[model samples]
Target: MEQQTQDKSTMVVFSGDLDKAMASFIIATGAAAMGKQVTMFFTFWGLNILRKEEYVNVKKTFMDKMFAKMMPQGPEKLGISKMNYGGLGAKMMKYTMKKKNIVTLKELIEMAQDLDVKMVACTMSMDVMGITKEELIDGLDYAGVASYLADADESKINLFI
Candidate 1:
């Protein structure tokens, strides 16, 4: 009798507003921390998270207003945590980091890369948003729908964020 091996994979697809993007990446980072092979596919609004300038300018869109009225507008307004207040929130983050030795989001990204998490940028969305390849961070892998599909096909855990 031949034994079949099970493949463990997690596909995190980002397609929502700023909060969603932040949440998805944080989860992906957590998954990597757990020794799992993680692949993050950024598409549509999710891809905006990869835009260097937009990372700090993420905003709530029309649809966001309809449903997430209570949510903050843009990454800057979005609290560093789900439980923190406004500007005081950001201040608290710096204080806590100094107290507990935590890393910033940019540092987390670098750590994620060091952990071998694959970050794929959707080429279709990039073209639609007029974002050139050079506009993205270096080493970001650009792929088409077929590539994402292939990833989904191989992934045992596929998520559309």
Candidate 2:
């Protein structure tokens, strides 16, 4: 009889919205808790969720500076995907979550890290978006799409958000 193994999950987080990030972490942590190895590939806007909360002083080109200025700095700065009327909707959603005693995105991120979820920042996307390693949070693997594809190939579940 062929041995059957049930484990491994991979996700491509493509959205920078707070709700989507939260969902990704929630799923990732759940899978990790269930004894599955989880990998999260953060590309494009999703990279914002891994950024540092404080400003990172790094020399950059004019375009890079502009991009850095326009993008959100960290998880707390992300807006909701819908009904975000200039960030008001995000605020309301956050307030409601707090009132309901739901876990915060930051807490979920910490939980994911503690659970040993592999988080990879897309190198190509970082270059295109003018993001530097210093601007991102620590303890992340930096790789390109091929790395994500490899993990996805071995995974039983895959998601793009």
Candidate 3:
């Protein structure tokens, strides 16, 4: 009998909401823990989750600075998808998770990184959003749609968040 290889999971994280970002990272880490190859493709608003809260002091155009100023810097600054009363909802959710002994979104993200999950930033979206590599967390691969598609083609499971 021919041997089958380990499964692969590909996730496209398209939302910047704290809940969705948590879900995506949780799933990616879970799959990685299961010995599956996992890849997370971050595009558009999803890039916000990977952003650094502190400014990187990189030179940019006026539009880039404007975009940086308008968007939330990191996961901690992200608002919830629903019932976000000026960010209060997200704070409440975090408190609830802590009370329940559930992993925080930030911790989950760290776990995903430690588990060696492939994190890919969408270059096209970065260009449009004026996000530079200096603004994102370290150790991420940057690629275009074609690269993501190729990974998806080989993946046994695919999800869009």
Candidate 4:
């Protein structure tokens, strides 16, 4: 872990779509299992994936409240990028994945956490969206682009999803 070298994998998650978030977690867990140092930086809409599934009692401005109300709480509420059809597509996709025994996004997130894959939430994005750290899940690092860049610079692989 001390060595910042080629065995590192980094991804900037800028999409909140269920498919994109799942893909990011899948890659992160897979890379971690392969013994790579993985870091997933979530920004903008992607931050929604880290939000608490239950409503958090955090004080916010009117605009912030609006954003919170509109944004998805967690992986379960995320919509697919295409064919969402008012979230029906996401529901269908989750059902099919479960039927096929494919690991769901929530499971992938747990795997990533268990594997020690770093999950970073962009503080700047959170501020803009009126999201508080308390509103997100636990065991996450709050940072800015500089921190993400540092990880990316040391990583052999970097992706923006």
Candidate 5:
């Protein structure tokens, strides 16, 4: 009989707002970069980031006043480091990223997808949020509770963040 080696880490479930969605991806990206299998289940607003169209429509809260004015609207407006100081924060972020050559959220999402990060959208949330599968990006993993739990149960690092 052949013995199989199990992955050291379990699943990580992320549930929350847009910022939380970005944070979750950062963690998933790190874990995957470290050679650990990562699964990011997006429910509710978190799923917005996964939508191809919404990617360009990602809006910052009132907190991004200046940034909102200078940078593009939606996720495309945010730079790496996920820092938005509220005032010149967006501009400073754009300037810093330009100086340091950092990647954008859109780029991260693309990279994560290419790396097989397992992006799943919540059917329940979709229905409630009035988002249809057609509204989501093509080629993404989409499902309901049974599907999500299938991954959640296999995960040891479950988080509701």
Candidate 6:
């Protein structure tokens, strides 16, 4: 019998918004659970979602420290894309999700990791933003646009968020 290849799903996460990040993770995890090969390429502000909440105390340049202090620390600190109301909107959204019994974004990300979904952090974006590997969550690959394009080219499903 001939073996069938699994479908591939590639997602380019470019948004830092809490809601959008949650959506991306939800889709990635769902596809992975369905036995599809999934890759999530995080770029630009999307990288913020993978940042560590606690300070890592890594030696960085003055500018890098400034950038780190200015940006959201992690997924829990991300604001909504619209009507953020100084972060109130994000809190409200989390509360609503909890009330509705929806899986939290953190949980979705954890599930994706557990399912062996590939997580790639865009090197170009990191360089431009002065974000170091130590600031991001562990167990993720670092690559550039060409790498993401390679995966996207083979993917039947692709999304940019």
lDDT string, candidate 5, 8-92, tens digits: 2333333433345456767677766766556776665465565554433443355433432443223543333345555355567
Report how far residue 70 has shifted in candidate 6, in Å: 1.1
Tens-place lDDT digits, model 1, residues 15-72:
5443455557677788778776777877665654555544332344555334333433
Alpha-carbon deviation at 110 in model 5, angstroms = 1.2
lDDT of 4 by residue, 17-89 (tens): 9999998998899899999989999999999999989988988999999999998899999999999999999
Error of 6 at 143 (Å): 0.6
The C-alpha local distance difference test score for the whole of candidate 1 amounts to 0.61
TM-score of each: 0.63, 0.97, 0.94, 0.97, 0.65, 0.94
**lDDT per prediction?**
0.61, 0.94, 0.91, 0.93, 0.58, 0.91
**Measured by TM-score, how close is model 6 to the native structure?**
0.94
Candidate scoring better on lDDT of 2 and 3: 2
* Candidate 3: count of backbone clashes, pairs at least 3 residues apart or interchain: 0
Stretches > 4 Å off in candidate 2: 1-5
lDDT (Cα) of model 2: 0.94
Off by over 4 Å in 6: 1-6
- Estimate the overall C-alpha local distance difference test score of candidate 4: 0.93
Residues 60-115, model 2: lDDT tens digits: 99999999899888989999999999899999999999999999999999999999
Which residues of candidate 1, in runs, are more than 4 Å off?
1-12, 16-18, 54-103
Model 3 regions more than 4 Å off: 1-6
> Which residue segments of model 5 deviate by more than 4 Å?
1-19, 54-74, 77-95
How close is each model in CA RMSD to the real structure? 6.6, 1.5, 1.8, 1.7, 7.0, 2.0
| lDDT over C-alpha atoms for residue 85 of model 1 | 58
Cα lDDT tens digits for candidate 6, 6-30: 4888999999999999889989998
Question: Which pairs, if any, clash in model 4?
Answer: none
Worst 10 residues of 2 by lDDT: 1-10
